[model samples]
Every structure is written in C-alpha cells, then in structure tokens.
Target: MSLKGKVALVTGSSRGIGKVIALKLAEEGAKLVINYPVADEAESAQQVVEEIEDLGAEAIALQADVTAMEEVKGMVKEVKQEFDTIDILVNNAGITRDTLLLRMKEEDWDAVLDVNLKGAFNVTKAISRIMMKQRSGRIINISSVVGLMGNAGQSNYAASKAGLIGFTKSVAKELAPRGVTANAIAPGFIETAMTDQLSDKVVEQMLSVIPANSFGQPEDVADTALFLASEGAKYITGEVIRVDGGMTM
Candidate 1:
C-alpha cells in the first residue's frame, strides 16, 4: 500500500467529495480521521469509519466545525492522541452561498468565506505544526474551476475558492523547506450533492462546453488527490490541478 502506516485527516468528510477522499486514502492503507461539522451526523461519519475498519484499516470520526478555531484545535488534539502525527491533510470542508452581487447578503458572503477559506486556514495551521516538526506532510486544498473561470450567481463561492488557490501557493512556499507540500485541486463539474441541484438542462449546457462531455465523479477527484499525496508527487507543490476535463483549458 502506498500510504501504509500513514495518518490522514480529511475535514468535512462525512459525505460527498470529502467522504470519497477519506475512503480512497484508507484503501491505500492510511489511517483515517474523518471530521464533520454537524454533530448530529455522527452516523454518516460512523459509516465511513466502519467501511475503513472493514478494509482492515484503523479509522475514527471527529466532530468539529472547521469554521471554529477552537473546534479545529480540539479535533487536532483528538487525532494526535490517537495517531500522534498526521501525514496528509485534506481541506475539503466547504459551503457555497450562491447569489448575484446585487442580492447577496453580507452574512452570505461572510459565511461562505469563513467556512470555505478560513476553515482551511484554521485546520491547516493546526496540523502543519506537527507536519513541520516531522519534516514531511501533504496538504491538499479542494478548490473549484469556477474560482478560475468565474460563474454568474456564485460570486461569494468563487471568491472563497479563488482565495484558496492563493493561500495554497503561499503555504506551499512557506512549508517547502520543511518537506511539507501544499497544493489545490480545482474540480470542474463534479457530480455530487452540490451539482445534483442543477437541472438536467443546466447540466446539458455545462457538458456542451466541457471537452470531456461528461460530469466528473467524486472518485475522479479522489484519484488525483491520492497521486498528489503519494511519493511520486513529493516535488510538486503550490500548484492548482484542474480536474475539469478540459473545461478550464
């Protein structure tokens, strides 16, 4: 297994892309720390943990709101107690408050920025310290193609994701010397709970523009993430890989 004996903490991994990432990493033999913001959703987190255990790997679910610094700290503390160190950190917790600029509320903007951008900052800050000490780690931030190409009615979401790209680059530069790598995955139109809300006509319109002529799956993003976290990608950092199937090209 490529990740045998490694520990990975994936934030907001209760479902969707995050869940897939966690499972994929576990399949590669990484011990898993699954985090969820919603305390009531322990069952969702537990399901992932059970699956990992069934694969003969260790797993644990942690409840922490990534937007809350205190909660992030607590989550890190729990992971440290169980695993001692984190080799991979996936900042996958994000939320979108989509609306046109004219109708977007201050709260909407703040909420999106806080959860999508600041949440990554908080969790990465907490975990990078241990990684820097170990002199090795992989940090992958989940971004979106909309952050690169921009999209109507999603100004706040786009800004938060774009901000992640800049933040990922800066963090990568700062941590490179310590053997820590930070990168971003900008997914185009991945078929997830987020995209399920779009009508079939809307999806058809999107597919017309995408060269691949299909929506990306969560596993597609997870596969890219697994490669980035592997030794093969050790030298790669501060890069935003578009898993958009040529849509951004």
Candidate 2:
C-alpha cells in the first residue's frame, strides 16, 4: 500500500472514521487534504493536518460544506493548486436525522439527504474532472449497513446512504473508461463517540446480532478504505464492500 506521491482528499475528516481514514492514507505516504464543513471544525481539521505532518507526510486543512456546490468547487480548486492532481477521494461527509417515518419532519429528511447524498454528488462532480483528465483515480464513499438492511427510526439516513450506493455505481460506470474507479464502504456498528453513549443494554442488543459479538473499531473501516484506494483494488469498481462484522450476512 505504498502511496508515495499520491494525493488523497478525505471529506469530513476532522474526526471519527473519516479522520482515521485520512491518517491511514497518510501513513502509506499519500499527501492528505483534511476537509471540515464549518469554521467551528477548523481546529479539529488543522489538528488532523498536524497529525499527518507528524507522520512525515504533507497535509493541509480546508473548509467546505459538502452540500454546497460552490464551496465544494472552490475547495477542489485549492487542492489542485496545492497537489496538482488528486489520486484519491473519500466522500465521508454524512449526517443522521433519526426519527420514525410518521414523526419525521421535512427539514430532518432534507438535511440528511442533502449532506449524505447531495454532498457526495457535489464533491465527486468537482474532483472527478481532475481524475478523468489524469486518466486515473479512486473514489470511496462511506455508507452504512443501515442503508442495506434498513434500521428503525432512521429512514432518512438509510435513504441517503442507499442513494449513495446507486450514485457510486453510476459514477463508477461513467468514469471507468477514464481509469477512475468508484466504490462504497458500508460500515456496521463501529465504536465511535455515538456508540459510546449507548446504554449497556442497547450495546448488548446491538452486539447480539453481530457474528463477531463485538463492536468494530474505526481502524477496521479505515483499513478497508486504504485497500480500496490502493492499486490492488484497481480492477474493482461499482462495488459495495461491507466492513460490518458479518452483520448483514
């Protein structure tokens, strides 16, 4: 997985799984661009840049709301100026608005769909142009098992993620002739801050359905992203690789 000289852009990479993915790519010698949505997250994003620098790799922090096309385009411009080209793109910016269908508000539905689905659209549209011209690139979208099997009280989130899968496949086909491959990673119950807040009973219930009988770590998903971005996955495209401990199977 030696990615020396490769440039990777990871959205929503200030923290959580996205952050881990950014670090993992940097570890493999890829230059990184850490993206955060708002000013409030700038500190975290810069911290990620510092972490990458500490790993002896190059990185910079950029701010852009993925749902906004102009902002996404501006960010891509900056990335091109800094790195000249982008070899990898990770659409990991997503949000959840969990509520039952009957109680789900219009704003909640729109917000989730805009960030999870529309954001991927905005970023991919902007970065893929560079990849297409270069005749090579890797695109990885972070989806979820909920998008596959569905989950209670999360219709909007599930819909956004499922839509991402369709978008990924379409992008893959559209860009494959140009040597660009697009795929999605559907992660299961990964142990993050949100999972930490769950009650013992809730955690136990969640683990009961997993063949591993334990929660997955952020590294599990990051490792999968690393593989998808590497030359080893060059022949793979328009596929959904599950990092869920056999939960969907």
Candidate 3:
C-alpha cells in the first residue's frame, strides 16, 4: 500500500476517525493535508500534522468549512500551491443531529446534510477538477451503517449518509474513465468521540445487534480508507465497504 510521493487531503482529520485515516496514509508514505473547520481546532490539527511529520511524512493543517463553496475552493487552492497536485481525497468530515423525525428540527436536518452530504460534494467537485487533469486520484467517502439500515433517532444522519452512497457511485462513474476512483466506507459502531455520546441503554442496544460483540475502532475504518486509497484498489470504484461488526448484515 505504498503511496510514495502521493499527496492526500483528509477533511476533518484533526481527531477521531479522520485523524487515524490521515496517520494511516502518512504511514503509507503519502504527504498529508489535514483539514479541520474552525480556528479553535487549530491546536489539534497542528498536533496531527506534527504526528505525521514524526512518521517522516510531510503534512500541514488547513481549515475550511466544507459547507461553503468558496472556502472549499480556497482550501483546495492552498493544497495545490503546496503539493502541486492531489492524489487522494478522503471525505471524512461529518456531524450528527440525532432526533426522531417528528422531533428533528429543520436546522438539524440542514446542518447534517450540509456537512455530511453537501460538504462531500463541495470538496469532491473542487478536488475532482484537479484530479481530472492528473487523470489519477482516489476519493474515499466515510459513510455509516445507519445509512444502510435506518435508525430511529438518526433519520437525518441516515439520509445524509445514504445521499453520500449515491453521490459516491455517481462520481465513480463520472471519473472512472479518467482513472479517478470513488468509494464509500460505511462503519457500524466505531469507538470515537461521537459514539461516546450514546447512552448506556443505546450502547447496549447496539452491542446486542452487533455479531462481533464489540464496537469497532477508528483505526478499523482508517485501515479500510487506506485500502481504498491504495493502488491495490485501483480497479475498485462505486463500492461501499462496511466496517460495521456485522450489524447491517
């Protein structure tokens, strides 16, 4: 899975699954661009960049709100200036506004979709323009198991992720001729700060459904992203690989 001389941009990579994915790519010899949203997250973003540097890979942290097209363009422009070209893009930034359909606020739905689905579109479109010229690139989107099998309190989240699956497939078809591959990774219950917010009862419910009897880790999803980004997956596109503990199956 050597990515020597490749340049990878992982959005929302300051922490959790995104951070781990960035590290995994760095370990594979890819120079990294860690993307976080807010100024307050600069410290953690720099920390991740330092960690990648420690691994003997070049890395820098950039901030951009994926929901905004201009900001996304600026981030990609900066990356092009620094790396010359992008070889890999991981759309790992997402947020949840969990609530039953009846109780879900309009803002919650919009926010989740903006960051999870529209954000991927914004970043992918911007990066694809660059990749089209390069004629070779990897786009790995981080989806979720709930998107496969709907959840009660996560209607908005599920919708956003389901949207990503469709978007991934479409991009794969559109970019494949140019040798740009796009795929989605749907993870079950990954042990991340996001999952930490679940109540004990909710956790128990999830565990009962998972055949693995244990939750997954961020590294698990990161490894999958690594595979999708590697040369080994050159022929794989428009596919969704699940990292859930057999929860959806």
Q: Which TM-score value belongs to model 2? A: 0.98
Q: Tell me the tens digit of each residue's lDDT in model 2 across 1-249.
A: 899999999999999999999999999999999999999999999999999999999999999999999999999999989989999999998887777999999999999999999999999999998999999999999999989988988999999999999999999999999999999999999998656765798778889999988889999999999999998999999999999899889
Over 4 Å off, model 1: none
TM-score, every prediction: 0.98, 0.98, 0.99
lDDT of 1 by residue, 6-95 (tens): 999999998999999999999999999999998788999999999999999999999999999999999999999999889999999988
Lowest summed lDDT across 10 adjacent residues in model 1 is found at: 195-204
lDDT of 3 by residue, 113-206 (tens): 9999999999999999899898999999999988888899899999999999999999999999999999999999999999999999999998
Q: Which residue pairs in candidate 2 have backbone atoms (N, alpha carbon, C) closer than 3 angstroms, thus clashing?
A: none
Ranking by TM-score: 3, 1, 2
What order do you get sorting by lDDT, best first?
A: 3, 1, 2
Q: How far does residue 20 in candidate 2 sit from its true spot (Å)?
A: 0.4
TM-score-best of 1 and 3: 3
lDDT of 3: 0.96
Best by lDDT: 3
